[model samples]
Target: MLSSLALLSVVLPSALAATTYDMVKEYSGSTFFNDWNFYGQFDNLTNGDAIFVTSSVASSSKLAYVDSTTNRAIIKVDNTSTVAFNDKRNTVRISSKDEFDIGSVWIADMYHVPFGCSVWPAFWSQAPNWPSGGEIDTFEHWNLELHNQMTLHTEPGCTQASPVQTATVVNSTDCSFQDNSNAGCGVMDSTDSSYGAKFAAAQGGVFVTEMAESGISVWFFPRSSVPASLSSNASSFSTADLGTPTANWPTAGCAIDTYFKAQNLIFDITLCGDAAGAASVFQQTCSGVCYTDYVVGNGSVYDNAYFDVASVRVYSVTGMNTIVRVSSALGFRAGCWVWGAAALSGAVVLFAL
Candidate 1:
């Protein structure tokens, strides 16, 4: 009886805790565009001076394509054509066809990210219902800021808890969209190589985000610092390997499972929009107004505005049993593994029988 009780204490916890993560979807190479839905419209959300082109326009104009030389995907703005002072330049906005819920991990391997004066680029995830479903900005920054900002925007109640384990600095703790002028709960990366010209110069990096029941964590690994298990061909991953994250939003104050759900990954670049066009924000990076100096140009200023992506992969968590069947040492039924307290009581009855 003593031996059986000791075994139960050790094995029961493993049975409930063991989990495996599997790659459910991958967007990469030539087939990357097939899984995305292009947003062919104006920048209505931010009121930016950008025309999100249709798939046909994107292909015909070469705004989005796979680079033949590097075999990587490239989504870029129109740098060749001249735009009239009143017109908006052509750009691309796309969202994944698939939707992911919590208990998932997203990894993006990149060679470059869009950046320039008046350029607002973001790689993020959001649900269809806006703040109700929640929004997670994995990579976002504009103008001359050389650091990535990770943020979460939800309904009125969500906020970051104290002493969140992260390497980045917290910008705002309030995640409520209605509050803080829509700043959300933001954490800025400390490394200068986190965004823009500096990021591209160091050959780019990777952004990993895990949305779990406990909370949300984001990590930025530069080209030289990426883990070996996170390669493009990796079919599985263990979150335990990723050390202290760049930003962590614990569930002590915010219930992640209630706020975040059914999210679709998105990438878009809008020029001279709300965030980048604000007078106070625009003047910090470049001279002259955003619309007049940058958006209305001959497209020469946006030469560096593009995303050279290697791949974006999503992994879903699946529960699995890791405990081996007991050798009938405690008179347990064959192939019957106990779960909770009820199951454990039944096992004891079977042992007596």
Candidate 2:
């Protein structure tokens, strides 16, 4: 039998009024809605228009879905490959083929970025003309160790110097390949042992960048650590404890406030060489084959190629007024304090009467 999951909802107090929103749930058992629009060069779609299966390595994977439950929508990408050349041999390249846009806000969450001699996984956003509308790369990993980078590709006038933040692992000797430039991008080193065990292990989590009135706030939640409040309330997380700010952020050059406006959500995966203009960047990550054959014999090395989306919700805060009134006992105490002597005599007489 097909199952139906209840949509998640978030409620806030009147004093801290904010907007509330929710994303319509889609699962193995559900009907596809018309609000969704799919864009890319691939096939093998599934799961209520939420999942797309494709075989093209050098194709783009851009799919959008509307959350009927919240009037908002999300654009997603799945695993797709790109084309690149190693000296003379042509190779299908695989980087994180996922990118999306919401109104003016854009986002991309990357995983298994190509490395070694040649590999690049990028999760970036762009506007109309290359860098004209403004490009905000949530995370980008190039050929390096222990370092992750965050860059803003914009007009020449833009002055924000791209800052690269590095992650510090107590035991770096164990997983050295996992380390990279730690710009604003968060990191989980290979020394951790269980770094790339599976999808739930390697890239099992949520990287959210919200563009709201409060400004742009980026959050990274491991699969196990995501808060229910974020899943329920979606909109107002001002009071959430996201920890202290990082040092040397890209605040001086690029004003996040001006560039980040309200945006929709996107979830996608693609291969290298998919994005039209960014072919050179894609070439850097492509290997001999676009995708590696993990299906060895009867067993499979790609055991963790699944995205288990428990739910997606949105929220809008509601306003309410609270009233305070003086208690009866307090009123009587004031009268006694004001009419002491005269009231005492009158009280005795009245009591006797």
lDDT of each: 0.74, 0.28
| Tens-digit lDDT string for candidate 2 (238-353) | 42433321211244444555544222222333222222013232233333333232111211211222223333333222231111121222111000000011121121100000
Q: Clash pairs of candidate 1?
A: none
RMSD per prediction, one decimal?
17.2, 25.3
Residue 29 in model 2: shift from native, Å? 9.1
Query: How many pairs in model 1 have backbone atoms within 3 A of each other, for residues 3 or more apart or on separate chains, i.e. clashes?
Result: 0
